[model samples]
Target: MSPTVLPAACEVLVIGAGPAGSACARTLAQAGREVLLVDQHEFPREKVCGDGLIPDAHAALRALGVYDEVMDRAFRAQHVRCVAPRGGHVDVPGTLAVLPRRELDDIVCRAAREAGARFAAPWRFVAPLLDGERVVGARLKGPDGEHEVQARWVVLATGASVPPLVAAGVCERRAPSGVALRGYVHHPELAQTLRELQIVWHPRLSGGYGWIFPGPGGVFNVGAGLTGSHATEAGGRASMRDVNLRQMLEAFASVHAPAAELLERGELRGDWKGAPLRCSLGGARWSRPGLLVTGEAAGSTYAFSGEGIGKALETGLLAAAALLEGGDDAAVRARHEAALAGLKPRFALYEKASHVNHRPWLADLVVWRARRSPRILRRMSAVLEERQNPGRLLSWRGITKLMFE
Candidate 1:
């Protein structure tokens, strides 16, 4: 149960109860730190996501000791079907699963609570409590009223919400890296037949892609995401493209026959929802003084695939490790920043591969090559497993090799 009265102080104040915040809280609480995890929403709240768990997410789940619990509830799959605009396709093998954020977030948060972290919800973070330039705590507004809670350290894991980052003075880019629209579809027959996760690239969804991932029961997670919106220009300037995610979803169904069949035959569950994405780790400062940023607030999502859950959890754990190392404020900040920087090169490779989202013909070429080449298929599978960089398959030299060698 949530605490009725807020504590006067704690060792760590973690904002947001998503995967990142929960992971951090659990890690710290398990280490015997006084942790308080708060979120604006209650447990099992609806979250906009693709709900697909790749290999990285699987590894993170194992690290959190929740892999068994999550897999027990997840819809397991072995491969992801990559569909090209010209109808050619390739099945990349990997350990994959799907569990909507509603259930997944609740399970992780519960794990944190089970680890002895104090969990609270429906408590919105108002602003940071400042001691000069250093963050000392936070002002939160709960059901009762606004209250202040002091802490030795603070963590921002708010996930794509800009207001809190702005309030904390860590926000760099105000615009999101991308945007996506998705809704659940209940179709028992379709779910039964669609065993593999399906990702389709089409001319209709230029600069974007659509996905149909089967979930437990008769439900399927259907969505379209556009990452080309916030592309960097020739001189390092970023530009935002005007897009209508709802219309893009419709276009996806119209162009992709499988998506059309699902939409026409399946019953739509709830309403179509949209969410913004921060990709390629390009937004927000990693840390200031006593506070550090993790998860989507630090741009943990990938530009190429829009997958973030794993990286978010990993970054959160990194934050906990930095704090656990027992250092001055500057040392902790430097540690977190260095860890994030190490991941930047991989993020850059994903960004390079995102070019396929804009020119989907490239996917057709890849599918065509993979159909005849066992080596290409192996590399593709390796990419899904995070064993190989996507650039190895999507780069110019890679394209040349695909066509000839």
Candidate 2:
């Protein structure tokens, strides 16, 4: 594939070479379409995340033909253990995997390059090029200087970032839906504990939670996060920046049964890092003439669990399919929006579940019930497998089963 310089145009221009962008770019290029993928950062750049991929994410990787490469470098997680504030817990086993985002993202992006997408890195998107209300392409800034690259269509995969959407006037500039702080930990028992993926909930963290996930090579991804709207949902008055995630993590690790056990067994391996977990629930318009939003920009992250990687790739592929549906730009936009709308109800319930997770009492009851009932435990396991919908928490039978189990 020949390279298209910044000043040139292509059939498709995908901004932000993350999972969503790469997925879209790869799909387009593999179909013999002209695609140019741009990113401000080079490969192997750091991206803060839990780094755990559930079964659904694996399916996405398989579709992209990178699952084997990923699995070769990842740790296959065995059990998912959820801990409640009252020390009640449930441990269910499943097929999950963990790999640092820095590595996994690079692999996915490179797959795009190999599949024939022209990739340009360290090229920052400065603004949108609009002809009337249509986004013709983007004005990008890089070492060569500012220039415009026109495209038949523009796809935004700029996760949790606002400037791209703001520049396009697709939505008002705002922050990500939530915040997450993560870091690596080296533990003597990390290798053994890699069998269990732990999610810890605490009363103090009404709108947030802590996690201890074992990674490959004696390191684990240990962290905590609070939804940006957590305070508002919890009826607290704390500012977004005012909360110390590291401190909260320390508190949970020192007291919570699951977190404390890991802390006692491991040593903090590096500096505690964090990032914003942008949500899909906001009022952001997903599509306009010649432009569409996928990935985190489309609020693809599940509000309750902060699980997005699967949804990110899902939306990317969905957008790609819409492009191939052979419609005008307006018809394409409608196709993508309608497909994404199917997830809105689930996303809303996930947000409500995030709110409910903040309530220690209800969370404890659910955990306590699941811990005892084999049937509920099986269903819990199914949720991780995507066989059961997480939104089932809103169903009457689901509620009865959860509470009465």
- The lDDT per prediction is 0.92, 0.80
Per-residue lDDT tens digits for candidate 1, residues 317-403, read 999999999889989999999999999999999999999999999999999999998888999999988889999899988899888
Best by lDDT: 1
Q: Write one digit per residue (lDDT tens) for candidate 2, span 183-277.
A: 88787564664468888777777678888888888788988888755334244333454677878888877767656666676677767788877
> Which residue pairs clash in candidate 2?
178-228, 206-358, 280-299
Superposed by TM-score, candidate 2 places the C-alpha of residue 360 at a distance from the truth, in angstroms, of 1.9
What TM-score would you give candidate 2 relative to the actual structure? 0.92
Clashing residue pairs, candidate 1?
A: none
* TM per candidate: 0.97, 0.92
Off by over 4 Å in 1: 1-4, 231-240
